[model samples]
Target: MYKIISEETDKSGMKVLNIDKSDLIELMEDYKDRKYFLSSITGVDMKDHIDVIYHLHNFDKNDYICVKVSTTDEKVPSITKLWKAAIVDEREQYDLMGITFEGHDNLRRILLPDDWVGHPLRKDYDLNKVQYVSVDRDGNEHVSFDDKEGW
Candidate 1:
């Protein structure tokens, strides 16, 4: 059995189960054969590594278990192979935190542009500004959108 943590929530007490990244599917498949369904999948950026959180609940046990996958290589295990709901959340995590879900059938940018560089949700992100677009030296005029908005 995986170690469980009792995380305090505003709504009351919520039990949290912590599982290793490599064994995520193993944990899922254990209860999966008993029909435990997935509830949610999301991520938190921790600078050097990204933490992908997966929440699954068992109707029979009435308990919630979570799995965390962390990696600095930008490659993540494909939980999409087990849980279809992970498709969107994994894409969003990749787009925002730059965590690549390896082995995913179709992993792509979900919210930001395909060419967008850098993860927006990382702890090291600069909040003072989104990002400065480079000035086009090819005779194109550059104007700050804020400056023209007054017109």
Candidate 2:
């Protein structure tokens, strides 16, 4: 029921299905109903596009499959409704890869502070600029590029 773009195997011999971003939720729902559990979500920065990978496991058969969708606009549908495990996984991807998981509730940084400037995992992330984090007396954290403010 998925509009697959291609099917391939990763180096580790895991099945990978590259499908359109629109079909992600439907395919995930079917997988969920078939007793497949969400293993994890990983994001890869391909420079021109971002690849979002969903790992699924079927405990009954001891099978594993990966679903991949590539996006140029850095957006994909959120599978959090079908898989509760996607809550944190999606957040992590969003935080580090700069991908926007559309319809994701509470989509925000899981590792970096809200004010952090950029997604460090992205290929184009600036390494020359230094960012600092400091907490104020009220226990509120602040992010800044200015070294003096951070101290």
**Candidate closest to the true structure, highest lDDT:** 2
Give the Cα lDDT of each candidate: 0.68, 0.91
* Residue 38 lDDT in candidate 1: 80
Number of the top-ranking candidate, with TM-score as the measure: 2
Q: List, residue by residue over 48-87, the lDDT tens digit for candidate 2.
A: 9998989999999999999999999999999888888989
Clashing pairs in 2: none
Off by over 4 Å in 2: none
